[model samples]
Target: MALWTLFGLRQGSATTRWPAPGGDDGQADVLGMPRYHPERCGDGCSACADACPTGAIVADAAGGLEVDYSRCIACQLCVEACPDGAMTASGDWAFGVRRREDLRWAESGDPPASPAPTAGYRRSLHIRHVDAGSCNGCESELQALNNPIYNLHRLGIFFTPSPRFADLLLVTGPVTNAMIEPLKAAYEAMPEPRWVMATGTCAVSGALTGGGYAAQQGLGDILPVDVWLPGCPPNPAAIIEALLMFLDRMPQRVRGGQYGE
Candidate 1:
């Protein structure tokens, strides 16, 4: 333990100054969800939809294609399958939103305005995480938040064991049948003015494991969600951005299935 402590001291401060303007949020070369180009799509093309594992890309009623960000696992399958340049890979990963409709791709119209941040949770926020039916992928990323490199506590976000003291409920996995009652019990234990964040693609739209015998269609099937973060397992920086966005400290970057819109 003494040698390890000495090694830690020598490494100095490993935490990043991310989420601050001009700071590095890590994810330098990482490719996020695919970018959809409606103009490039062919009239009879459904290749992207056919290749998608999560049903994130589908044919609309107007003989057009629609991309839903919530169900996307960022596997880049659609990008590879598109004969045209319609579905292309991108680096736009900071996908946190207040409304579910904001995650869908629409050619026109604006998304519904999100409510202002609660006054009580501006500076500090307490989170209680529940694994409804996770595959442990999201939990692995969540554990990294406390490591020396990420150091989640520096941003005033913390995980609490007790729901009564938590300001937000962070849920993972595809809301399985067995865990539904337990998940509700945790929500009921929390005080009023509480918020819920769907932390992964499973929690956001259940990804590939949804609609089976046990799993439901993510947390929206059971709880009122204030934030929806979609990824197979979102990186640490993306998670931070989502939480901050939920607190209204950061702007929602993805709207109508487009990034930076």
Candidate 2:
């Protein structure tokens, strides 16, 4: 608690003044999305598709490329695989969903409602996270929320160690066979009006480990997932966007969207 206070004090003292309406912050270089240049591509090559571990890139018969944003792990393997600079990483990071379905690439064009409620009406969520035999990437991002940069506590989101006292269960990793029963027990232990968020590619789709001996399909096989954060290890910003979905502060993805509409 003292550490939090000291950090809070430091943040308060280090605050910067707002820039004028048209003024440049000089940090503009840090912003903007990545653009892909298809013209630089060499024809009759499928190296990018072959190199993608998740198979997010596909070459159509017409000799064009299709990148599935939802399936793309953002691992940058394709970016490196593109010898012609056809695949570039973008920084247009404003990925948010009001509906659950908007979280997927195949579900674009649907109208989604903002998932998060307006200010003063947000609910205080107590999240209980379970490892379930993960590689700890999810936990690392979860911990980032508490850091001064994210400061999830400012939005009334708290991480509690005990499932019994939690209002939401934030689960990581694929539900391994051995941990299935324990995961169920934890979900059952939570009180009424509870929510569960599956926070990784392993938890959402099982990904590479979906067919493993220890893996038990996915989290949906056990408890119903309210929100799905789709990444091998989701960025902290993605996790925050998902959390905001549960709070009803962001728009909900519409039908046929990546996340639930």
C-alpha lDDT of candidate 1 relative to the true structure: 0.89
Q: What is the Å distance of residue 203 in model 1 from its true position?
A: 0.9
Q: Runs in model 2 with CA error above 4 Å?
A: 1-45, 58-70, 83-86, 92-101, 111-121, 252-261
RMSD of 2: 5.7
For model 1, how does the per-residue alpha-carbon lDDT over 173-229 read when each residue is reduced to its tens digit?
999999999999999999888989999999999899988998998999799998999
Clashes of 2: 39
Residue-level lDDT of model 2, residues 118-178, one tens digit each, is 3354568888998876788878878877765556676677989899999888888888888
Candidate 2: residue 38 Cα off by (Å): 9.3
After TM-score superposition, the amount by which residue 101's alpha carbon in candidate 2 deviates from its true location, in angstroms, is 4.8
lDDT of 1 at 2: 100
lDDT of 1 at 42: 92
